[model samples]
Structure formats: structure tokens, C-alpha cells
Target: MSCPRTKPAWSSLLGNSRLTTIPIICFGHLSIMVQVGDEIPSISLCEENPSDYVDLKKELAEGNGLIIGVPAAFSPTCSDTHIPDYISSPSLSSAGKVFVVSVNDAFVMRAWGKSLDKEKKSGIRFLGDATGAFTKALSVDFDATSALGNVRSKRYAIKTVNGKVSGVFIEPDNTGLDVSAAQKILA
Candidate 1:
């Protein structure tokens, strides 16, 4: 026969008024965004066409890389300028493996990637954070329900070295292209 159920140690500790109260740290309420020196999270991002998944943490650990976070794929600024900058920039060849991450699905990201790099000449990899898990792990995902009817990643770029962020540029309003631009980051 199974013994009677008992409250866990945590519950007993919580009930002990005599024990000093310790404040718990809550990341859910944190408003801070990802910053330099933060380690990249081991989240999987997807790619379409042939269909594959990449673990960002593993990528980071393998070598230096750049992660560009955008609000959405095919949006005016993202389509017209942001991604194109990296595609056309000479520095891109030397910027290490580059990833363009968005909250869209794999199909949309694949199409957008093809549109941006029809010849696949550029090495930029378009990644779909379909569930926003990777984006949230970076602390760069934001609620864009009003504008996009879903949560999305803020505009940002992170330069990573062996899984650790060496540099970061995050757009203040999540809509601007000033800070996270390739020119600015390369400069």
C-alpha cells in the first residue's frame, strides 16, 4: 500500500514563519534585454526547403558567429534594407557564419531567404524561431500582438564568440534599424 501523501520540503519551508524570508528572483518580470557577455541559449531554430533544425548553442560553441534578430520576415524595413545590408556587405564574408532569425515559420523564412539571396551567393542563413523559444531565450522577443498579432523578436544583432556574446546592438523600440544595422555593427 502507498503511504499517505506529504507536503514537499519546499512547502514546509514556505510555511515556516520562523525561517527568514528570502526573496525569490523572478526572470518573468525582468525587463532587461540580452546584453554582451550573455551566453547564447541552446535553442533549436528551423530551416525549410530540405527542412532541418539547428541548435544555436551548438553553433555558437563551434565558432564565432553573428545573430541578427528581426521583427518579421518580408516586412518593409527588413526586406528592403536590414537583411539586404548583410547580403551585399563585403564584411559579411568575414563576419563568420551569419544567421537571420525571425519569429516566422520555416516556409516563410525559406522563401524570404531565397528572395534575398537568389543565387545563394551570400552565406547568410535564414532561421525560423517558429515558437519564439530561441528569441525568448535571448531575451529579445517582444509582444507585437497589435502590430503582428503575435509575439516577435526585437531588432538586434549579437556578435558571439564560442557561445558567449562579445558585442550586442539592440534597437530601443524594437522597430528601428539604426543601432542593429550591419554598417553600425561592422563599424
Candidate 2:
């Protein structure tokens, strides 16, 4: 695929001193965001530690599962609202193997997970996309450099059955606390 050279947009909000929007420059391929019926990507994500890797392709292929993608590990909305809903949702038990992924290192993810579920009662596993390969493969990544320091996954809830996407709930605002909320998906 040939990438088109598009001009960057300058914003008056910054006195037009710098480009506000960065054009998408594809090197050899264009990534289309994941859609329904898409199979889970065979990417290895970090689990608790850098050396501990977990691949969901095989696990998700066998049963129902939920993958919750967040922008950061301990951000305000993510820590206070988003993940707590899933952790406390009664219906989440039936959702099968629930995994929460973030574009953070394994240590941060592990610490955040423990802080939320001290007793590990949630049964939700926290995984790290340290290099964001998993998020990029899913095409759910967004440039969050302004707020979160780097590219991050948009808030999303993906339901999987037999390793194929059954439902996808992505927040329209990228980092909003709606649509992908547990109340909506778990119901």
C-alpha cells in the first residue's frame, strides 16, 4: 500500500506556531480498525512481569471472553470509574476470561491491578502492551501524546467468542467513560 503525503493542519489555538494534527503516514500498509467477525490477533502481551507473556488467541478461541482496552494504567477515569465498574459488575462472572490491557509496562499494570483488586476477587487479569504491538494489531490505538505522553489504546470493550469478535464498544471520544462502560457491555 502506498502512503499518501498529506499536509499537517495548523491550529490557531497554538498561535499557528506548530502543527496541531499529524497526518497519518503509512510506511507500507494501512491499518483498518478491527470490526465484527475479526479474529483475535496472535500477539503476546506481558502479564505481571516482562518475561511472563500471555497470548489470548488460543484461550479466546475456546470460549467467551472480554478484552477491555484502556488508555493508561492508573489514570483518573480508568482508576476511579472505568475499571471499577467491570471489577464490581455481577454479570462479569459470566463473561468468561476477562482481560484488561493498557499501554503500560508490566510493573505498572501489576501494581494498578493489585491496588484495584487487593484480594484478587475480580478474576480479571491485567496485561501490559509495553510496546503497543497488541493495541496496534487491534487497530484501537490513538495518539495520546498530549495528555498521556504517548500513543494509547482508546477506551474499548471487545467481546469475543471462539477467538472472533462478537461485539465492539468503543468510546467515540477515544477516552470517554461511556459506551465501553461495564454497565453497557455486561448488560
Candidate 3:
């Protein structure tokens, strides 16, 4: 006599191949990095305009915002292509407050900002997360010792509504633009 087969139990898909019955949040086929409904952590960032520090939580609370994370400021991909998308997009004005964040100092970010938005027409803010505190808080910071050296933020974008995360598009490889492009976010 054999027992009847029970329904297959789903489990949390942690990074490891090993699976367990433990339940956890997930995004598509991978384990969760950051997901909808999570509150954006309170952190301070250096802003280029007026050259002062601003609290992310306070800024995000005023309205919807887009946070764009790049590995570094002035990197080839970031400078030439990635950020320029957001800078040149006509839809950016309607995307609420947009911020380009990098793990570099304010001086570097300010210079890069000038290079991209020469007249500051886009209204997109370039912010410096020099200490990596804000990036780490989002759980998107990665170690790129081979190419970039030290810990750096994964290329990603987050859409926040009143300080709570409503949507997140994170690159699987930490450097690709497949999911985190401005066009995709505006869509």
C-alpha cells in the first residue's frame, strides 16, 4: 500500500541552489533584492545645487521620486550612455523628482552633473552617496573588486511613492541596463 502524493510545496528561493520550505519575498525567478511596498531607508545624500546635504526620506516624502543607482560617477557606460538617457528624456519632467546616485564624492558628482546637464535643464538631481550608506541600505551595493575596485552600487532604479517603494528594477548582473533603463521606468 502506497500513500497518496501531496501537493508540491513552494519554498523561498535564496541565492543558493539549495531550497527550503521557508517562505520569503521573491522577484521573478530570483530571490528578492528590493521589492514593492518596502519603505525607502532614511539616508543623507550630498546634492550639487546649493552644495548641501539632503535627507532622502524627507525629499521622497514630498512626492513620487525616481532613484537611479550607478556604480560610479564618470565611468564610461554611466557618463556616455546610462545617465544621459534620463537627462535627455522628455518624460523626465513628469517623472517627479529624479536623482542620479553614485558612490563618489560630491565634487566628482558636481563635475559630472555639469558635464551632462550643462544648463541644469533636466532638473534631475545628481547626488553623492560617497559613504555607500544609502546604497547599502537599499541592499543593492555589490563588490566589484576586479574591475572597479572596492564595494559599489548595482545599476538599478527605484520608483517611490511618498517614501515607500512602489516598483524596483535591478540588474541581475549588477552592471547591465536591460531592466533599469529610464525608458523602461517611464513606461
Task: Identify the runs in model 1 with alpha carbons over 4 angstroms from their true place.
Answer: 1-28, 49-51
Candidate with best lDDT = 2
Q: What value of lDDT does candidate 1 attain over all alpha carbons?
A: 0.86
Q: Give candidate 2's TM-score.
A: 0.85
RMSD of each: 9.8, 5.7, 9.3
Write down the lDDT of every candidate, Cα atoms only: 0.86, 0.91, 0.83
Q: After superposition, how far is residue 183 of candidate 3 from its true place, in Å?
A: 1.6
Ranking by TM-score: 2, 1, 3
- Looking at model 2, residue 144 earns an lDDT score of 91
On residues 1-187, what C-alpha lDDT tens digit does candidate 3 reach at each position? 1233432254334544555444444343222467899888788889764359978788888688999999988998898888998888878877798899988888889999999999999988899988888888888988887887778999999999988888899998899887998788877
lDDT for 23 (candidate 3): 45
Lowest-lDDT window of 10 residues in candidate 3?
A: 1-10
Provide TM-scores for the models: 0.82, 0.85, 0.79
- Over 17-38, each residue of candidate 1 has an lDDT whose tens digit, in order, gives 7543444443445545677888
Model 3 off-target regions past 4 Å?
1-32, 49-51
Name the best candidate (by TM-score).
Answer: 2
Ranking by lDDT: 2, 1, 3
